[model samples]
Target: MDHVRNANPFTSQSSYSRGSVLAWRIVTPVSWLILVITSIYYSATKPHEGKYSRHTIWGQNSHRHTPFALNSVIASLYWIALYILQVPYLSSLFKEDNTLPLTLASHFTAHNLLTFGFIHLWCRSYFWWALLLVIINWFNLTFAYFRYPKTPRVTHVAIIAGPLAWAFVSLYWDGAAAVHSHHTAARIVANVFLWTWLVYGAFYIVAFKDWAMGFALSILAAALGVGQFFTAIIALQWIFAFTIMAVLFVASLPVAAPGVFGGDVFKRGEVVSEDRERAPLLAEP
Candidate 1:
């Protein structure tokens, strides 16, 4: 009873092995650095031709000519923001007495490796394979999201929810490319899939109280709307995208904003400081 009462949720380290902590401390940064270098390399070396070119989307040809595609510039900016958030999250894992849970470490490693594979496959015009990678990444990130600690909200966004949002959006973008079918049935299915963003955003917000995921989806929806609008001025896809964006943006406020609805959403309330004169700690069993 005393041990249970004295346990600190934020700082408990006994469950982790030293080797797991050490390995991830070295592996995580190296994997992230590799991804950065390769992304830059692919973006620079791949030449822009046209829709049929191997470097169709990432080169000077920024437009993807698809309803579900996000504006390339906006997508790039989102990735940049995600990467910047990752720096602090990765650094936090290296703090003294911080033990990396095996489950999180495994998912993190797989997500990074699959992401590395995805960039290469995507640049090579292997849309089907890239879509496969994104699917795996989506499931892996979802598991990581639930497994991860919720406090210190920035890291939660950085490590799990943000990447999950990207994966969720990429499913449509990559799936469209993989199919590349102009049949009315296929087009109808694609249009229907767009609404899943709204469904997913709503589910996360209500079920998990995860405003970060909802916000990420909202921003991505806006980007998709921008792309769809420029692709076809008369189409309703852009209108649908924008509507989803508005709905998610509004719905997410309760869990994120502070007042009657939200209270210290980002504050690490579990981490009690010593100045508060906590009860004396008991040795772990």
Candidate 2:
């Protein structure tokens, strides 16, 4: 698969492997490893600095304690709005006529507003969340790429390259086809990117790993699975996806437990050297 350089410009080298360009073609468990590591490290270290941290609602001790709170609230609002709209209970509401509920329109409006606004905000922060979205979408493309028998390595590369190419075209070159959308295409693309990641992520867990990884994967899968049921009932896939994304996003808040907190390193206060001059003199002597 075509590899994009690591998004962090400060990195000395890119994280992608040049030799195994087609490595992303297969939906191996390892594909999720990068995200798992990134999420865990962010949680454990609670680093105050970095692009990802900036967009995060929560941070180390001083900042917000619950990073995922905003996401959770938003997700809950979306679901509640759908329920009030009665989109899910449409069949029962209009048994004989089978007319669609007015609530469906409201649900769609709210879903688009939330998603578009979130993406715009996330992009401004240059947070890893946006990049993660892209990566998840690419993972889906990879699955499609490998579905064929004897898939050519170049084909795999093309699949990986597609998004990068689109990103470039959208951002820099201003390709007309990529743009000029009424936001429908953009919404669909974003959903595909997200759901693909969740689906492949589930498959990856089953294909490789033990209990711990399996358990984590199961939780993630369960979230999506529950979300899917709601979508089927309400015909609100975007809303369902957005709600699940919010829950997953909130659940990933970074928290340092006991000895794990970075603050412990500075518990007593900053250590000071009392004999700095004497040490220098002794060294010279």
Candidate 3:
């Protein structure tokens, strides 16, 4: 009983590990903040509803000012990439002594591969890119369940990086006129992607030992999940708004819980591993 009961939720560790997590998490709220501030400014200062008003309908295409849009891009990327890139930080949580971030060099270029947006110029407007994102989302969900074999770590990057990069490209390609013409069709797929990101991304964070980060994340999710409704991004109306608000709020509340991969990590409120070895701790039991 004691052996099974010994898992500590806040298992103390070297400053480096804790710092890595903290440093990375700092971007979470900041990115959200930038989004919030920019969203408000973007909406408030928007050109009075004339020709541009059509584009204003969808939050995706609303921001036109290059500087504002670019700033939003930077903050948004930092917010998301911090957590997604934590594939290394995540590996270290179950292992010890070794640098979780370092394991990438052994495989392929995880960091560079994450910059999938650069390809937008070449891969413009093809249905295949969207299809590829679908594959990547599945890989992320599968990896979240599996968590080892480490190959999925790169795919995890694809989870967000792929969609986000596409968002940038698609919105650019769609332009103001196309946005009005295809808002419904676009939202159909975009909503699916939104929920998918929320799902896998939430699961990834919950898999960690950081309860505080999870809770903070939840608060952000709730506010933004609800806020998205006001932005008119998803045309499904109140049901969609209420559902998203409820789900996002819930995601951050529990770090580890029963039925999460049928594991006791959360129900026990434990860290699950403290195996301070130099090599990455590939074994999880």
Candidate 4:
């Protein structure tokens, strides 16, 4: 029998469904696959046409390959993001050492803050907003870390949605212009990839399972797109990014599927570990 937990604001135990879990399992990675392919195609083909003009979906001349500086900056951020995302998986490698996850998580999250600040702090806007939301995201996880049994279901929703929503909103703003250069196009694709996670996060926001895959995949995808941005030939950098991400994606797939991530998976951990109820063990006397 299923051991249903306490009520969340948006859903009850009845909200849990195997169909939803399976849908997410199938949809989460597939969405990233589609986005990555489209991004790679755009980065490869569109930059070659000898034209100062390319009509975008928003009807802007969105095909001018901008200078390398913009992409270089964006690309650096992506690398940093990838590094940060890797920490969790690596923590699993350190599972024999119990405290390693905390040490690694702190180190990387700090690195993320510094790197993230350096990248976007100088921007015209969105710094405070980004940092604040990130703190909230971290708060959810921190709470789950220290107080799993007491942490409510709604908090898990926050953990699931926080980063995806922030990245999604930020990326949506990316398309405020057009995808002229490798940088612009990269940002746009990052937005769309993140948008997929936001949709997946929505399922968890109400009530669902296996949030690890959606969360990890979305972060890695956005990081890949960010890392891809560069002043070099679009094709070269895109291929590099795609190759690196393809490997990362495949490697992470099993990790997410099994919840092998060292840290708290989805704030509440998995079902069996978290459920508070247990029936009599056949009264084996």
Q: Which candidate tops TM-score?
A: 1
> TM-scores, in order shown?
0.82, 0.23, 0.38, 0.28
Query: For model 4, how does the per-residue alpha-carbon lDDT over 1-285 read when each residue is reduced to its tens digit?
Result: 232321221233234355433443344334334433443343334332322443321122122332211233343344335434443433332233222222223322443343344223213223344345445545544343333322222222222233333343333333332233345576455434534434444443224343443444344444444533543345444444444345445543443454565544433343233232222112323
Give the per-residue lDDT digits (tens) of candidate 2, residues 8-115: 221222233433222222222232233334433443443355453343321321132111112223323433333333222322222321111111222222322333
Per-residue accuracy of model 3 over 1-285 as CA lDDT, tens digit each: 433222221122332445444543444334334444444444335333432222221233333221012223433543455445544544443444434332322222222232232222112322244334434533443343243223233333432333333333233223322333345565464445445434544554556433333333333334334434445543553234346446645654454444564555444222233243243334333
Which should have the higher lDDT, number 2 or number 3? Answer: 3
Of candidates 2 and 1, the better by TM-score: 1
- State candidate 2's TM-score: 0.23
The residue pairs in collision within model 1 are none
Estimate the lDDT of model 4. 0.36
- Candidate 4 residues lying further than 4 Å off, grouped into runs, are 1-126, 149-215, 218-244, 256-285
Model 1: runs farther than 4 Å from truth?
A: 1-17, 47-53, 60-64, 100-103, 149-151, 182-185, 260-283
lDDT of each candidate versus the true structure: 0.72, 0.30, 0.37, 0.36
Better of 1 and 2 by lDDT: 1
Find the candidate with the highest lDDT and give its number: 1
